[model samples]
Target: MKKILLLLNICIFILGKEIHAQTNFPYYQDIQEFKKKDSLKFPPKNGILFIGSSTFTKWKDVQAYFPGYSIINRGFGGSTLLDEIRYVPDIVYPYHPRQVIIYCGDNDFAFSDTVTSADVLNRFKILFELIRKEYPAIPVDYISIKYSPSREKLWNKMKSANRLISNYLKTQIHAEYIDIDPVMLDANKKINKSLYLDDMLHMKPEGYRLWEKVIKPYLIKD
Candidate 1:
């Protein structure tokens, strides 16, 4: 009887530890909100699904920006590439989106001092593979990391990562690298201050207007 009691205590401890670990995960509440929303009404399958960090999350008018298209935004703020990878099964695959447009990697670099351009590329490749493995032939578009005044120090690293990913995408069918960095730059080849919000990181309405023009051409047609 004592042995049985001891084993039960161990099992309970292990279970509690797992629960604690999950609760402590970054953006756990955001993911749970998504799950709750899903339970209430599943997003339409075969629509364009946008997933990424705060950049995409803050684009609350995404659907309005692209009228006449079926669109679903699953972006969570303060998320990184790894966060998307961890939640892909919950936030991505279930939607069965016809196309996936991603805008990540910004927070990845901001959050880690040790991360490199190659590391970002490898992380993106992992996400690309995960999607392709499940939904072969579905088109995926990765929006290049933008040049922001706030993250000027990491500009070179972000540019290098974009270059690597863009080059790799060229070799894969149904994969596209949307480069909007150039447009975000002024004629002097510097970040246009007018495009960003006061924080100098996130974009303003003007910035998204530029993004819309650049990205619309690549969007899949109905």
Candidate 2:
């Protein structure tokens, strides 16, 4: 009986520390064929892959704004930076794009009981480590978490996490840090109503317009 209990504890410990694998969602194949009907090879010249949480997932007008560029949005809603870290091999690496714009972590802030702000930062560190190993030359860009007019309670925590990410980027030459937090916020430090949708979390068309403007200058061919 003691041996059985010990073996069970060992199994539980191993499972607890294990990182879960990501499967290619059925929607991914559909997303892979957007704007381009022709089959193509991996590592398309100047292809820009936009990845992350709902921010990337919810970009329906991405192509309309970012024309003359092969930009692909691979956003998975309700996911954190850690989930992206686990899935990049299938979602990002296969594409082999020159540039990747990662917009996420808004949901990661206390979205799951398992992940925290510090956990998000740690996941990003792990992600950067993986990127350095797998795709050293690729430029990784981080889109800042947006201000939520309604979730005032989480605002401080959000800002703190953003600062952490910005600070971490100080050392990475290929990583570009972007923050539209100022534009999204009003003088009161709350989300600007004009920029937000009815939900107060997602952006209205105007909010995305502002984001498009900020990101336009940073995009470049590799």
Q: Pick by TM-score: which candidate is best?
A: 1
Query: lDDT of candidate 1 vs native?
Result: 0.85
Per-residue lDDT of 77-174 in model 2, one digit per residue for the tens? 65676566656665676677788788877777756654456656666766666666768887888887776776666766778778898899888888
The clash numbers for all candidates, in the given order, read 0, 0
Model 2 clash tally?
Answer: 0
Best by lDDT: 1
Give a tens-digit lDDT track for model 1, residues 74-173: 9997798877776777678889989999999978899999888877877787778778888989999999998889998999999899999999999999
Residue 191, model 2: Cα distance from true site in angstroms: 2.1
* Model 2 alpha-carbon miss at residue 1, Å: 30
TM-score of each: 0.88, 0.78
lDDT of each: 0.85, 0.70
